[model samples]
Target: MNTRKRQLAMTALGVATLAITAVGTQGAPPAPPWFTWTTVVNNGDFMPTDSCVPTAPSTPPCRTFNSYNQPSVNANQVVVIRARSRGGQGGQAVHGVYTRDMAAAGPVVRILDRSTLVPQPNNLDSTFIEPPSFPRIDIGMDTVATRGNHQPVWRYFLDDVTETRAGTTGVYTNPFGDLIAGASKLGAVPDFSFFEVPEAPGTPFDVFPGAPAVTDGATIAFKGNYPVNGVGKTGVYYRDLENAPIPLSADNLEPAGGSNPVVLIANSLDTFIPGTRTIFGSTAPPSAANRQMVFAGFDNEDKPTLGGIYLAPLNGTTQPPLRTLVAIGGQVPGENSKARFNRLGEGVSFDGRFVAFWGAWGTEKKTLVLQCRTEGNADRVAFCNQQHPNGFITTVPVNQGIFVHDLGTRQTQVVAKTPADYDDFVYWNFSGRTPGTGEGDDDGELARWRSASFVAVSGLVDGTLTDATFHAAFKARTGILMSGTYAEPVDGIYLREGPGKASLLTLVETDMDGSLIDPEAVDDLGAALPVTEMGIERDGFRGNSLVINASMGTEETGWAGIYLTEVPE
Candidate 1:
């Protein structure tokens, strides 16, 4: 075999291998073996007016479905998400407005038609966007109830849709509701529909429905936690769609209020914010100490005596709650040189200890990985920490702006960065190394397990728009789906396929690179499923690269919605 002939033969073989297709479950189109794509939601056609994106008469039957897209046609999983900026001083987003998204796998996409109360975008000065969910979904929306213009305000919608005290309900994809925070809830309508969480549950601060997955086919899984103070507020939680109004007044869930009485904790409007969260130690509950690090507060206003790492043991069935933990960002005179801190976007991990956050304190322009030692009242100081661990083949900020931090590493890698002036996002994955248990100790028995890996990360840049951007300017995202296959953000959808793996997947787009309408469309189409924005877990729908596009005047009608495609391999 001559050199040229050998090369030609190998090339042909590769092409042939790429062409092989496998039929997904229940008669889906034949796509590449072990690889499938699907559409979960497509509300792009809905009119932009009305509190809920008007469910205009459409050919695709809008069936009522679960927002937390669960179930899998095969090994792969997915979710479609949409959102519009709040158009206020800061570009804050209100999510979880739509009902269920269209789901596609292989060549088959299923869209559920239901009377969903989608939120109406202000359309004033915001960008409506729809992205795909990989390991889990992160969606929430808000609604405002005002008596005319000058009247008193009533209810407020986070996603700008659900009618408070009226027809407002959260749907989840997980089958059995959880015992922790009400991250999972049944829909107001559609008897059995479940709503996926829109915000990321920051562990060590709070725990909600997270790590969404389908086990044993019909069994859906999400994270659950126990609240500390009666007002300590339980973390991002899940309400078993099957077990609404769960009778969980135990120390495990809500820590009974009175002498072992359950505390009635309320979740905040920002419950579903995306970022990294940690799981409490295996030994929690029963003990009154801080059982977990489900939630943490961000105090950038002023530097305090104790860094903003809140820690207050729960009083006996009698005492009130203790002080909260905090870490100030910026210089604090004679304080430690760590300076002030800034929390990257919000999200979480399974165990609820170690966290990945970004900060811009004096002098240091970098990221940090803060860790907690114990769970519950025993939540001592951070024991293990890994700051801004990157998994790129080249020397780059592996995973910048840490969003969702997990204990076990996966096959995710950071690919590329976006150019200036472009809309860019970042993506993270659990790029499993050949030897999963190395890096720290040789015994492979170091403190439970080795929670370290060379993460595969990527970012996209635009061809136009050249502006200097600090590393903090970009953000990260992730989503979940039925099959459990997580889709971490990559450079573009066109990137070649690797072996399927990951618990969560999300796309992180960078901000402002000259022009990036085409790639954004491509990435959008590739990352999203037919159904979007309503699942407990999300994946792959992430990356940090961005392409700037021509501004759409406020004349727009519809709010931003995530869209995607599943091309034939």
Candidate 2:
């Protein structure tokens, strides 16, 4: 198994032990509450279907499917992508994208529905096409996207199963669950799209599943496998959500032997689409702003060069100037001799000026920095030093931590580092496990703030880490929502403002008393709030509003639901 997979396995094992006895040893005053909880869409609710009325169209009635996956929000509305059963017809489950105000009266309106979209062959190639329905939507399959300028709008890219013939069934499917060809697709190009989301039922757009389009006058920074000489080619493409899509990274665009662009996203919360709002702060204004996008790409062959992150304007022809932000190998400027970003981290500032991600450095590199314990091995001299004898052991101040790059300054700074002392270990919850959902699996993604000043990262960080310096640096920051792990006395969600203090907000599940206990209300940091299984996944921010998916019962008897917790400014 790869390093990340191994760490997750270890995390799962740690969780097993903690579930038996999650009791806080010492007591402290309750920290102030930072967020107010609200339920956006739960599994039990019936989503509206066949709601739109196209000027000239007749689509089938909508179907309902449980399970809410993606949650995105803007100043106006919160949108979620939900799947519906095909009623057992056979092919795949259909999906719909809906928006709401958190308190809309009737059934939430679904903007895009499977019955409304029909896959057609990409005119350029007879075989290549888009996924015909929502059952084919897979965000974890490297299909990441963003709205044009992070505005609430239509989707720019999406994927689904391919049709058999130009309009038939029986297309080839892959392990990733995407249809490859239209009965006769040639080459390895996967079924994908770069079109707009259909505005009304029966008004089909060419692209596959994508984030909402750039309705708010934003640009689109999306990734897809477009056809090159009839063969599938992967690259980062930019569009203003107006004209055609432009390739930022593609074959022949990079120097000889260079690899394709592998863009980083804020998190694995949804398909790699830009949501309506940018989480990190940006100086770039709305006017003429959708012209550029930031991404990571490698132009060097042979050495696997950790690659360099690049930015390009949407106006450029051929390939824009490939500005290298930070590269791992080669004589590249800003190259970190000790570490390279394997898979780029997520969350870019609005202006495309700043980017935040986790990095791999020395032998101490980790997919989840929370795994780097600091207690007995507080110095990290044991495992960390063993991993990088020449790097962190001798030179680097901190081995692996979160870092941010300023496109304007061309500089990278460590936002937070693994504690050098065991007493200062950061805590994250690993108890929110969902078998097929890939929930607890994504333990430590970078949670960035809209101001770009502070970031809320996951892992098992407890209340003890709070100190004078921690508070001063993080006090002004919000959006730190992490799962409570076995490392703590309880397994619940914890909220903190800045780094001064953390409050045990609620448990993954209610306690034995059958009540969702509030630790703050009880004035006890380790108060045993009652609840049953309620582990949360994809807990993140849409601007300052937080969205998460939680399962109410164990996998056998529980159901998953989507929630919205508004952060108080």
Candidate 3:
């Protein structure tokens, strides 16, 4: 919605764009611009309404709190927010749809269709996740079993939400219907089912199946599949939404291990190429590339870990990967490299050529968005600078200036350097990484990016570091990608560097209600929005790129859900 300009205009794409603002005319009040808001899903009812042009002193913003988790829509334009009623609920709950301008009114909202995405049945747990389809959601839950090689299995449900939250796009639905009611067709391994675990004795296993229950209002998702190199996998896992999983096409479907990978994306959606190859050598077609339609898990040998950014091909993927960029890959944390999770943060170049992985381990140890160059070399394995921790050489802050790596020349230049860390003059400071589309970001033709920043952690929460999303080329305009501390609401926003790299973020100011990260702010990076999970959705979620955070927990209960936000362009 390029409604940036004040003049009302309609593009060829039927997307209505009009800036709304309120102002007072002495004793006389004039309406601003005519606008329409559709209450898609919420606690409200289906009642199309209208409102005169808002007459406030600033721009008018509308909020649609998540009523469903992994809210998905179909080509029929049906938007469904996945959800589950109280604990004792059964089968799929309400699934709402709507037309345009359903919320022209204030409170009451309307629905295009008011039917559950799927009819109640044998407790088919639909794990919601976004595929490569635009504005369309896909089910990460599995419908049938195939050769998944152990990657946290997932099947396409067309639309809905999953459990796991935060940066993890893969998630499982609560066990519904009859306990032990499912087919183990593929030889019967540890696969998900709708049968709710029994609470008493061994009746059926308490609560639902799978990991511990996610926290309320926390967005989470599953991380890796089976395993990678004998390491547990990680990906964006989030809860907290009324829906299931909302695939974050930017972070590269990866779970937490504390660090950035060495991959880049050319699309803002999941894309995958089987680890296996075809007898023909060229590999298989896109459809056959998945090998397993549902992601059950990955090879246990390659247990997934955080960003250990290395390069490996699917056992049977395409001959030459359509794309290659940094992604989570490591037997464990630190990847035995200088980059530790504490200072991990990065950016990828277009065309999957170069990667900017940053991290700062020790004191004299500053942040470093290590310039990882991957010039279409699939065999190229990313090796971190050993001098990282003990203070080898590279010492850039998460906000270091003029940081750009030119692949053509294989050169790393830090154009801008500050006296020292922002906190203390004796130390140097820096940062980088914008939440924009990692796709098509060929270093040759870079577009948008973010500025990673760190706040001086103190007291109990020693390392209270945060990442801010800024524009590429290190510009400080407005909007920054930063998380809020439990103390403050609306954490932070995408920052657009000014003429001199000065920041002008939106959340800090527009947060009229005090705090509560604005759900709308997640869409700053073009159609790419910050999601509960991490990863890239190059092909409708079939291929995800992100890191899994195993140490993550929820706001109230134990660890749950994943967290992600848009990077400013």
Top TM-score prediction, candidate number: 2
Per-candidate TM equals: 0.31, 0.46, 0.29
Model 2: how far residue 264 lies from native, Å: 18
Write the number of the candidate with greater TM-score, choosing between 2 and 3.
2
lDDT of 1 by residue, 200-264 (tens): 22112222222332222222223333334443332222122222332322312221111111221
Reference-based lDDT, each prediction: 0.23, 0.31, 0.21
Report lDDT (Cα) of residue 344, candidate 3: 27
Per lDDT, the best of the predicted structures is 2
Q: After aligning candidate 2 to the native by TM-score, how far in Å is the CA of 474 from where it should be?
A: 14
Candidate 2 residue 288 Cα shift, in angstroms, is 13
Measured over all alpha carbons after superposition, the RMSD of each candidate to the real structure, in angstroms, is: 19.9, 16.1, 19.8
Off by over 4 Å in 1: 1-75, 82-294, 298-355, 363-569
List the candidate 3 regions with Cα displacement exceeding 4 Å: 1-40, 45-224, 227-490, 495-503, 507-569
lDDT of 2 by residue, 217-295 (tens): 3233443333333532334433332222223333221111111222222111221222223222111111112355555
Candidate 3 lDDT over 338-453, as tens digits, reads 43323223221111222233233333434323333222211221121222322223343332222322223333323222222112111111111113322111111222221333
